[model samples]
Target: MQEEFISVWVRDPRIQKEDFWHAYMDYEICLHTNSLAFNKKSSCVRRRYSEFVWLRQKLHDNALLLAHIPELPPKNPFFSLNNARQITARMEGLRFFLEEIVRCPVLLSDSCLHLFLQSQLSVKKIEACAEGRSRYTVAEAIQSSGCRVQRFCSEEHSQEEGETDSE
Candidate 1:
């Protein structure tokens, strides 16, 4: 039997400007998997810190009785993109939060988690999509929005095995 696994990487912090006075950092969330639970083989979506907070709250409220939800990184009111240390800390925190989330099977089955990881939809749209009110399925929304879908390569498995053998 093939081993089923999923890996999520949260990186590439880029600041998006809504207007002259408003700007915020968003990270590239890339997921690679052979797990049957996900709709796609791989996906990449850009999300801001606030979106992560919203996901955490949604998961907590919806799955509170089913599983233990992990806490997200503390919100920094004075967040600055220019600060290297702060960016690194937040990136690590966000990565850890996602890693922990994917570990829970109960959480893995949630539509909110699937939409958040797989599509570029806003929080409201994700909620709509999850509720079956949207015209597009998650995969269709992902394609329509032109979100990045990465192709997994067999070479990566060989490289991982080579590194493990050398270690």
Candidate 2:
């Protein structure tokens, strides 16, 4: 899944090598031991690890990271102004760019369970909720969920997550 995501980015003419390198690193950050070419369990890669969705997240994160690069291009017309203003303006554009990326379902699917709970459910309940389980248990269960959408559910709960292409 990771390689496929990287391959797509690498093949795209719009993305330069450095951009793809950063994107690849961001993609690696998003994955676990369940998938990716280097994992021993790679052969058992789940169907739900949608390449499109995974790639979307990679690209989005890369965009956010790159958006922070200081606008220090030596000969830019805006060099006369303070560097802070130029950087701030660039950051604003980057924020908007990220917002557009966030609108895509694939990238948005990378939603963190922690963030979801913190915002929607209160912080106190989250800690109390984890009391009965081994730490690895929940993460393994999430990885086992057949698709990206299903991965969001907690362990000990076995609702069908999604219908994969093989199904």
* Each candidate structure's count of clashing pairs: 0, 1
Clashes of 1: 0
lDDT accuracy of residue 28 in candidate 2: 11
Per-residue CA lDDT of model 1 for 5-115, tens digit only, reads 777778789999999998999998887788888867677789999999999999988897898888888998887889989999998899888988998999988888988
Best prediction by TM-score: 1
lDDT of 2 at 130: 34
Clashing pairs in 2: 48-147
* Residue 58 displacement in candidate 1 (angstroms): 0.8
- Please estimate how well model 1 matches the true structure, expressed as its whole-model Cα lDDT: 0.82
For candidate 2, give the lDDT of residue 123: 25
Off by over 4 Å in 1: 142-145, 150-167
